[model samples]
Target: MESTLQIMPVQRTSRNFGEYAEEAVIIEEPIIKQKRPLFIEANTIEASLEHLRNDCIIPVFAKDNEATLSHVAFIEVVQDAT
Candidate 1:
């Protein structure tokens, strides 16, 4: 089965530091939806990112399934800033 991937633009609001510090707000704008496979053969994060760069989709999990998959329903992508 094919999975739908939604690409959205993330906007970060300015932060205010004062007596009451306000947290930055994040806004997501829907850009486009692309069809991709739910699973793929990727050994590392680089491999998964490669798939995302070339195929425009991130694999939810590796096909090998070597480790325990998360029970969370939502998918989160975390990247290092450094």
Candidate 2:
């Protein structure tokens, strides 16, 4: 006597949770504008010092609204003096 085995395919189903359904709703928040420190670059020491001068505006190169890393020097301005 010969015996044959039968195979069956299983179906997948997604489980729903109450917490996941609550998290699906997104709440929009108001955006607040804040002042951020900007770093400037210069070639020489004199040029770097020039950038540190108050009320001095320097040209900066950026791509896609972001600063690039190819600058020659970097300067950070401190608001509070100790």
What RMSD, rounded to one decimal, does every model reach?
Answer: 29.4, 15.7
**Tens digits of per-residue lDDT for model 1, 9-37:** 99999876575967889999998988754
Worst 10 residues of 2 by lDDT: 73-82
Please, what are the lDDT tens digits per residue for candidate 2 over residues 4-48?
A: 998988899878676566545789999998776444433324445
lDDT of each: 0.52, 0.52
Q: For this target, which candidate reaches the highest lDDT against the unseen true structure?
A: 1
What C-alpha lDDT, on a 0 to 100 scale, does residue 21 get in candidate 1? 68
Screening candidate 2 with a backbone cut-off below 3 angstroms (N, C-alpha, C), the clashing residue pairs are 41-73
* Deviation in Å, model 2, residue 42 alpha carbon: 12
lDDT for 30 in candidate 2 is 97
- The regions of model 1 sitting more than 4 angstroms off are 19-82
